[model samples]
Target: MSTTTAPEAAEAPAAPQLSHGLKQRHLSMIALGGVIGAGLFVGSGAGIAVAGPGIILAFVAAGLLVMLIMRMLGEMSAAHPASGSFSVHAEREIGPWAGLTTGWLYWVMIGVAVAVEATAAGAIMHSWVTGVPAFVWVGIFMAFFCATNLTAVKNFGEFEFWFAAIKITAIVAFLTLGVLGVTGVIGHAPGTANLTGRGGFLPHGGDGLITGLLPAVFAYGGLEAVTIAAAESDDPRRNVANAVRTAVWRIAIFYIGTMALAVTLVPWDDPDVVALGPYVTVLQLLNVPGAALAMKIVVLIALLSAMNANIYSASRMVYSLVTRGLGPRALAKVTGGVPRLSVLASCGFGFAAVLAGYIWPDTIFLWLLNSTGVAILVLWLFIGAAQLRMRRRVERENPDLLTVRMWAFPYLTWLAIAAVVALLALMTTSADNRAQLYAAGVLVTALGAVGLWHQRCTAATAATAQEPGRTP
Candidate 1:
């Protein structure tokens, strides 16, 4: 009998393989778009409802956490860029299961978000044109974005650049107008009384501020999209590092600063804030004629912009998963450096979800949204874990490759995990969010089952081949 030992594998580095057509400006705007979504334009109402004038604190706290998460992600992404971003990091540092779970969860999240954004745009359009149904508008939006994403990657970046530019312009304009109004330069100079007068700034108490953090965190959900987009950008490492480094200041100015000016210009509990819309409320107070109408256009653009980005993200994520042999291989095919089949398949799902909502008219969208609620959090958790593992390996292997390291090393990584756990706990406390916790559990179980099944099949195949005295 001859005993053979397993041979040691060569330690050859894998070559990087991602298309790079995205320019610097496109990368910057993609980062900007990720931070500024329909959440800031429309969903801010929900946070305002809970926190009153203290929502500013909620935004600030959430922004800090998001900054920490982005930094960690940046460190890993800069060190080894991948189309799957953090998921690829998970596969390298943790295991294939981690990558599979995080990648599919994020893909589902983006798909559902596409439906949500389309429905939002549909609702707005239905308001203006009473004859058309909301689902019809959703259909139109799905088709529009489907075509956009099915084209080259540059086309998608171009569209998002304009979308983000509009949102950025609107926020800056809002802030400028706000300062003018507060200083008695533009309108009646509402002053800071709106902040102090209405329930003394902390109107709803600390609980309100805590509750407000939920939606505020949601507002920062899309910032990770920038890292994914970096996979297709020129100089992805530098672009991702720059974007993550500057994310904090941009979010502070756009979200916290804008919300501060909003509450300062008008009372948190003002009827206009609740009824007319936050942006419109401030504009109306400034006696800006046709301002409400103008903002309606801006909000529409915001919704469309979100829809476009969501479709692009979902397609690319699915493409990455397919290439890893976790999904259908057809989705991995790229023509003109674009995942055409994946784009079609993703948009098909979006269209189907929208149609189901239209036909059921009862619980489709709600279920979709709840199912994807904890997914972003799941992605962040994986990112934190992957970064923790990968950073150590990178240090051991190549200590000099530390251009964009996370601050505080293992401590900050653990802190991020703790924060994610707390957020999950908080989700259980709310009736509206409790469903998400349940959905997350079910998703985890499903992913585990699939992974185990795949492992068993692979093992069986190897065993059968070995029995036949053939190589597996």
Candidate 2:
């Protein structure tokens, strides 16, 4: 897992190489599927319980912020696509230190998330087949995805396509069924009772709406995967631009629209609602046939889809670092430009996290989860900063290359930056979120220190090498 480079291979990569194996269909589905995380299906219950039916407004606000961030990211990604993604942008617009810091932090975050997803999938399996140990199921899921990633880039795309398809279909079907039930078209649902009776939509007042914003912001975290996946796309510029523009609105529809139906069909304060997950609770009330089993299947697909997406993004990121001589040299080796070693390393970290979860649930295990809690904000902060600089440079020097410009130029971009700052500030208000903020602070600090040290070493080595030709 150490990123140390081998002596002989510790040189600049000869080329930035990767196969353009991801098809247009894969790119489209990745954008759609990225937003439909398993967390939304299960974890949203907690957010709803806190915010009440006013959660829809909270989602709208957060969704708008994300739309702006994507605009900034899309602007840069289209002009210059690389597997390193925001890291590559950071290096060009900010410095190598920023790129290395963001790249490794995000890379490690993705690896950790893989473990989290595997554990979630395993739990669902445990529910069905009560006899099997959850850890064993986690191992099988990890291995299955590992093999899927190790073989070929195209194979990864295919796997993700089907996985995403199932997730998307389930969400759509849920929305449809929710509407029917609320209207008494099918099943028993008290229309508007949940939304209206729930303290007139804001059980906890405006504070509840603000409270709902936290989960909504977090839920929108995975949309950045589209930009990352666009690098290996056939036409990076167009693909990135297309995905960003199209995915943003579609994601808004899926997230906000789904929340509206959920809150309408199921009251926010229903007993044991959060414990059962709102989807399951609603389906049970509506008396859907095999609702429990069907919903469980959907949840499993959601987890696996996330696993596939994160593993792909994490490996590509590490491969980017190695290609640029930022990590271990062995990871730079690519067969069919897939960087199989990098994938293995990424999955390895995930499995290691799984073991840590078993050994130290309260200590290291909790830290592992909290450490990357605010990474989405950190990434957006960098993206916003990088865009503020890169936008001017692109406009002045490479005007024609600016395919996907940030809307309203600096105005909206800066607005997005301010929103991220506000979200981070607000996150501290809750004890639960405060733990995440504190842990993320430690992580950013550690990465920053390492980045500075690496920068200094690179500088010193260059200075010494140049001294050999001195005339003195």
Candidate 3:
């Protein structure tokens, strides 16, 4: 039986084939846009509220973790580029169950994010034109993206390029404004006094600093999308490495630098910090005319851009999973090098979530967010575990395949796993994030069961085929 299994494994096909459809520019811009999200534009206010001026520290801490995760993922992706990214790595390194779990979890994450982004865009649109209902705008946004994704990959790349450009331009403008404000070049110098003025740098003590990390960590969630996008690029390994290398610096500079300026320009404890968006607050402090209106436009663009990317990523991931035999095979087919049916199926759930949000107007969206939050956690955990296993396997199988490698190999991989565990443990202690911890536990258990079942089924099928002279 062992001898028979060996030949079957040896004859198994190489990983699923994907069209090298995306370009380097598309990937680079995706990386840039990944680091900029509604969180940086609107949601950083929550972090500022918790940690006072020490939110800078939170951004730095979270950025480091993101950098580490990207490095581990890059190593695996460079060696075996695939559309599924970490999900493919999980199957090769860990087991089939790991792939199933991480793939489905990530699919849920992208779906929920699409709904969240669409809702955010709708809110902004309704604010601008009270006569247009939010649900109408939501439907419009979904329909537009569904068409975009169903087109050829190059067209999708073109769309992402512009979408990412808008968000990147906004961040650059915000950073420039911050520098001028800090140097006292724009009106009176707000000075660094806001940092220590209200409650000192560490006003709320270590607890506040730790509490601030929750949102800061969440802000970096989208960066991994770049690695997945890299699989479809013409030069997968080179582009993935370049994007990962450059994106780390951009995230730190843009996210940490902007948050530092934000906390410095205005008192972290200011009442308006929570009410008005942080970026808008900075503009208002600079006394820029119509700054609030300008920021609303930027936020709307940011939300739309995120929605577009999430829809694309979700569809591509499902297509990849299906090709690997982990999902419905029909989804794996490509028409004009685009998975048309898969794109629609992926967006269908997102549209449903949006409709549910509109109907309930309250509870459903929050539950969706909670359920999907666990998915992000599961994804990082799998990336870390898969990298650890794959690194060793690569050394044994192909020692020359270390052109782009993780910094510390097994050590860094283990540390990343520890960091994921710590974050999960920390989530349990938070009133708001505790629900995510429970959800993550349920997901992990379900994945484990499914993996075991797949292994048994495969073994049984192999044994049955051997008993009869009936070849599979």
Candidate 4:
């Protein structure tokens, strides 16, 4: 028998196929769970406190912006679906440098997000086991969910489906009961008593409305998970298109409608609305049975679900980066059609996030979170830019695959980019959030510089290899 050498062993390929196990329901639920999160459940209180009833308008504005971003993303994903989502598109349409920066930046954001979500869940779950510490809870939650993600794509999908279903059910129930209570169906006759009773719609005036817009936009952050999850489905193109459409409508309804209901059921001026959380305050006012406890459970579910989704997304993105020659190629190796190494690597950030929070909750952790403050905004801007270029290529190469086209092509695409920039500019005006915006700007600048350096090195290395007399 002939012995194979090291070269031969190095040439052997590992498994690379990703399992397509996500079904229609899985896609639907992932889409739902991605957008509706703890942000909406709890974070909206800040906006409600600031804008009062006008928070509904803020949600509408942010929702529309999100819709535009989704449309641009859907168009690209439909034509060419990739687990990397916008990062892959950026590479093809923009440049290798843009893709590198965007992918790494997005990965960082999600990694941090995973840790934050775990910490939040751990805090809430601390009550169940008095002796066990919060960090241990974070570790346990991260380990268990990471295992599920490492097992099969379908497993992640199923987990997210149930997770999202619970959130949706809670939101729908709250909206229904709140609406009935506000309309006086539960007590008094139908009226706008709670809505205008406080200080009219613009309680704090237009500045409050503007202030509310930023939080509303951030609340829509996890939406890109649907597009990322699309690659694990059999009919990714069709699934993404449908999911995008429905997700848009649901965001508008759940965000705008829920905000409207919340403010209407419970006066926005009420201290409990902000201090106790808008959802809980509204539900308690309606006297829903065990509203506080139920909402607590729901918040935990939402955070954990988001953490699970992020773990899956970040792993896929890293796997895509490796396949594209932008990451450690070892991560590209697939076990059971899952990027197990990437999953482990992505989940590793949980420790870093926890440590940062522990070390300096006010400074270091704040910076880490703030550094990603405008990350979603930056991601959207890049996606819109990618769509502008990719659209022409898709039309020329495979027009038939243009099942999900961006609205108005280059025209609307430019508008979306401009809108995102405007939002960033708007962010700088807010004293509380400006530090985060500036920190994100600095982070983005560094990423761009590093990406440029990497590009130059790659080009130089390629050129040297082409020279017959030059040694690499």
Clash numbers, per candidate: 0, 0, 0, 0
Please give, for residues 1-472, the per-residue lDDT of candidate 3 as tens digits.
0112222121123334446778889998888886578888888998899899999999998888888898888788777777788887877776666677788778877898898889889878988789999878988999998898888777778877887888788788888988898898997887668987877998899889988987888888888788888878999888998888888878788889989989988888877788886898998999888888887887787788888888888887887777766778877767776778789999998998887777865577666677777567678888888778778778998967666788877787788789878877888778778887766567667767886687568668888887867787
TM-scores vs. true structure, each candidate: 0.92, 0.94, 0.94, 0.94
Candidate 1 C-alpha lDDT tens digits along 101-178 = 777888877887777779889999999998999878888888888998877788989998999899899899989998
TM-score of model 3 vs. true structure: 0.94
The lDDT of each candidate is: 0.79, 0.84, 0.80, 0.85
Q: Give the C-alpha miss distance for residue 381 in model 3, angstroms.
A: 1.2
Candidate 2 C-alpha lDDT tens digits along 1-472: 1222232122245344678888888998999897788778888888888899888999999899999999899898899887888887876676666778899989878888888899989988997789999999999999988888887778888888888898888888888888898788986658578888948889998778888898889899888888888988888889988989899888898888878888888778886568878888888888888887887888888889999899999998888887766788889887776788899999999999989888988899799789888898998999999999888877888888788888898899889999999989998888988999999999888887887687678767766767977642
Candidate numbers, best lDDT first, in rank order: 4, 2, 3, 1
Better of 1 and 3 by lDDT: 3
How much lDDT does candidate 1 score? 0.79
* Clashing residue pairs found in predicted model 3: none
lDDT value, residue 281 of candidate 3: 90
Q: Tens digits of per-residue lDDT for model 4 on 11-35?
A: 1234658889999899889988987
| C-alpha RMSD values across all candidates | 4.1, 3.8, 2.8, 5.4
Span of 10 residues, lowest total lDDT, candidate 2: 1-10
For lDDT, the strongest prediction is 4
Give the clashing pairs for model 4.
Answer: none
Worst 10 residues of 3 by lDDT: 1-10
In terms of lDDT, the poorest run of 10 residues in model 1 is 1-10
